[model samples]
Target chain A: MTTTVIEESFRPGELEVRPDGTGNLLGSRCRSCGAHFFPTREACAGCLSQDLDAVKFSTEGVLYTYSVVRQSTPAFEVPYAIGYVDFPEGVRIMGQIAGLEFDEITIGMPMTLSLEPFGENEEGDPLTGYRFRPAEVTND
Target chain B: MTDVHVVGVGMTRFGKHPDKDATDLGAAALLEAVADAGIDPRIIESAYVGHVFQGMVTGQRILAQVGLAGLPLSNVENACSSGATAIREASLAIRAGENDVVVAVGTEHLTSKFSGALTPDPSDPEAAVGATMPGVYAMRATRYMEDHGMTREQLALIPVKNKANAARNPLAHFRKEITVADVLESRPIADPLNLHDCSPVTDGAAAVIVMSDRAAKKYANGRGVRLAASALRSGSVDVTPTSMTFEPLTWATAQDAYERAGIGPDEVDFAEVHDCFSIAEVLRVEGLGLFEQGSYPWAVERGEADINGRLPINPSGGLIGKGHPLGGTGVAQVVELVRQLRGEAGDRQIEGAKVGLAHCRGGKAVGIEGAACTVQILIR
Candidate 1:
């Protein structure tokens, strides 16, 4: 058997990618209070608590709202569905909506995290980024 | 403490001006305002200038061009509130007994900057995920529709009303009026928001001269409009997630202005708001307590937001029809308010208007309700 090493996430410290290709979004949870935040934080906005713990967020959420972005900066190609998903952790996350036709995505739809090839690093290596897909949409 | 008054106002024709730089535009508006006030340029004891994307000593450059250098000047950048914030700073100087006369100028050479969809600061995680300003407002529009049963056709009427008002404004960017079908069929920038519904990337500048009671009593000649209240506030950190459909930031800022001005929402005769998008006008008015929540769309459909309606909103065409120049936007709104109150807004003047309100909110940062919000109350 050939041993293989897994690549790191496109944005280290925000998204975690394990050797087995399993991953979760990284964030900060206030140790003093129970509030959570996305992409991590130094202090809690809710209570001004400096004590925060890095935690992984749930993979499932419900779409809060969405838009078919037909125009955007060059960093993103046009005509992509972008959305905000409210996770069970009481945090809303922004991400690219994937795994469905433009017309199929609707508000309050169930969503699941799906990692995909986002961009490359300085060394030109592939990086796995995250997107939200409908609950029934599956990827290998 | 002295009451503040707007002694003079001036603006450049709001449209693309590839030949002129921000400094040139600022200087032009400044000179026009000085002449309009019938005062010597040397009498302006201090200045505040607002601009974005115009690099390095923007205010200094404007002062240098207009022969008003060496005076105390502060360049303000509160994102879209930059221009409005400048006006507030100028008023504070008078109220604090620091200066008798001050000039606030807001200019932006946006066409010289980047085009396409404008995003928040690139470092923002929202921008990282491909957040366009139109997309954000479109999402709000979608949610507003879902929550209030607002139809697409009702939202389309906002642009229609604004562009029609813009058609009457010679200094506005869009002099031609548009229709509901035109707004609906225009090229889509984001879902449920088309190019027509969005404010154009415009280049323009505006200037206003604020004076203390002494200066105004000497120079106003009964023409000056009183700056009753100028309030500024930053978005608070949300302890709990707030509704995007309703803006507490706007309400809080407006409440501050109302309290300071000693006027209620019902007393306002007209308004000029930051309508960066059609949905934004709905949000801004409702947030300012001008209309009931989820009621602006239906009110607009009933021809209530028109220039000749019961309560005219954005009679100067707003950002949608008038054009938005980031820093120039807020100042231009004041110019409209003063004009309408003076009965000088030619074709789109709100008749017999005694009180006019202007609201500006700008920028987006994570974990905040809004970046910067300013509310101003002007009375004749």
Candidate 2:
């Protein structure tokens, strides 16, 4: 089986690519107001502070809400699950749910970010993007 | 500021219009409004037109079709609130003493332009990630059910009620009452939102003639609904993640309208709100303070939101039953308000109705609660 060599990120700013095949969602943290945002921001929405720093968000989050999308535009396939996961940074990010059955998904479930094959580039190279999966519970 | 009144309102039958274009529909609605006002078409000194998907000079095309090509005109676009924004701009013009009589028209030939689920702008990150309008609302419906204990059966009643109201509205797209079973059995567009739960892609137009007190006195012929307030607001960027079950954008816009009208939610006799989806009606009415927070689904089940209920909601059948032509949706809401307030609604008339409200919230952008929202209150 052939493997991907040259990989790229669909959204370079929102989704960071790592040489090690693992990356985190990027967001902005306001230095003055202590607020965080998704997809990053130039200024703090709360205090309008311009002192912002781009940071990687935690991979784990809680599923706040979700839906099974049956119809969509031509870009994406149909019958995929989508939801918003609330990260510790106080930002809720929406993405397609992966690695979970439709019936197995529920609100308030613990989810961990997982990078997987997403789409192609202008040169038709496969790219890695992020999705959420159920965090494995440990038997303590 | 001078008191503004909707001297007349008109709307074309909302459904598939293969023969008519946006300009044709707009001119038809405009001429109807002018005739309804019992005034010469030349009395309209200025105009505002709202549309989306239709290209530039859409307003100019409508003016040319209506034979008022030389009049000063402006075209407005604010997502689904485009038409309502046009009305708000016209009201502001009178309040600013810019014009005594102005016409606002909203028209869209949506069936020709789009058929499937609408999306945010292509540049939006959400669009790139496969977000459909139905999918977003379905997620909200799921969250609302999870947060408020709203059952699936109860949510089905919203479409049922709206379609029943549509049966009486001659100009509505749907005239047959549907059942909760119909909603459950319909093809699923998104989980928790079936075909019936979503508004249709329609092609239609609606127009309203707003006049200052002086023009109203001459053209009203004892039929004028006071445009008490026309308030608009854009969605605030979310500094922190907020509840999907509530609409801060809708509340803020309605608050501006309430303060300007010097009235509270309790005084509103009836309302026509944007019900693009079944869940949207719940969010809008509750957000507008027509009902308590997290309580609209149960309210729909209790017959409290019926045509003859304690507080009538969507007496014109809303976007669901009446059909949603995007740009036309907002103006049609005002047309319904004017008809109900004037006791001109033939079969679905809300008798003795004096105060009516129209709410429109449209467009969805990433990181915001909503895109643009407008609230207009009318008193007769």
The lDDT for every candidate, in the order shown, is 0.91, 0.91
lDDT of 2 by residue, A39-131 (tens): 778788899999999899999999999999998887788889989999998989888888778988899999888777788888888887777
Write model 2 residue lDDT over B1-380, tens digit each, in one string.
79999998889999999998999998999999999998899889999999997889899999998789999899999999999999999999999999999999999999999978998897776776778899999999999998999998999999999999999999889999999999999999989999999999999999999999988888898899999999999998888899999999999999999999999999998999999999999999999999999888888888999988989999888999999988899999999999998888999998788999999999988888899999999998
Q: Fraction of reference contacts reproduced per prediction?
A: 0.61, 0.75
Show model 1 residue runs off by greater than 4 Å. A1-5, A137-140
Report the number of the highest-DockQ candidate.
2
Clashes (N, CA, C under 3 Å) per candidate: 0, 0
- Model 1 reproduced share of reference interface contacts: 0.61
Model 2 ranges off by over 4 Å: A1-6, A137-140
Q: How well does candidate 1 score on lDDT at residue B196? A: 92
